[model samples]
Target: MDYRQRRRIKVWGKAEYVEGDSALIERLRIPGYPAKVERAILFHVEALSENCSQHIPIRYSATEVEAMMAPLVARIEELEQKFVGE
Candidate 1:
């Protein structure tokens, strides 16, 4: 999923805003797989979640395990941006 989001993504004139990031509607191309999987992810950071939901269940997705710490990431970035302007 992360690979699909980072490497290549396609949105058919539609997009979803998630976790301060744009979730581009994309389909994963897996050879030999008869199904085209649709997935999304956080671009700049990750998604943190203690309570599971439909979109994000389990602990984390591919790319990294600390994805469940998205809140922390956003907070850290927010503080950094506020303290240091770049």
Candidate 2:
């Protein structure tokens, strides 16, 4: 018999689009119309702890997801280019 622990991530709340999520958009320094960025949907990412089986929210914005992924996307592109000898 084997006992394994499973960890999961969950979105605690429904993603919502707010027309003026300026405070977050500004804080992230996302360049674009503040209102537009704010209008993007937002949600909470939660981590499930094995011991507690409770969802603990991780503070981050759904709007900034693109911004956060930019660097990784660039890196992947670079890697692909290198692999292709380009």
Give TM per candidate: 0.24, 0.31
lDDT (Cα, tens digit) per residue for candidate 1, span 1-86: 23323332233333444442223333234467776445544344334333323343243365565775777889999999998985
Best by lDDT: 2
Estimate every model's Cα lDDT from 0 to 1: 0.49, 0.58
lDDT digits (tens) for residues 1-86 of candidate 2: 11122334333556766566677656756566444443456675554333333443344466677889999999999999999995
Best by TM-score: 2
* Clash totals for all candidate models: 2, 0
- Candidate 2 — which residues are off by over 4 angstroms? 1-54
Q: Worst lDDT window (10 residues) for model 2?
A: 1-10
What residue pairs are clashing in model 1? 48-68, 48-70
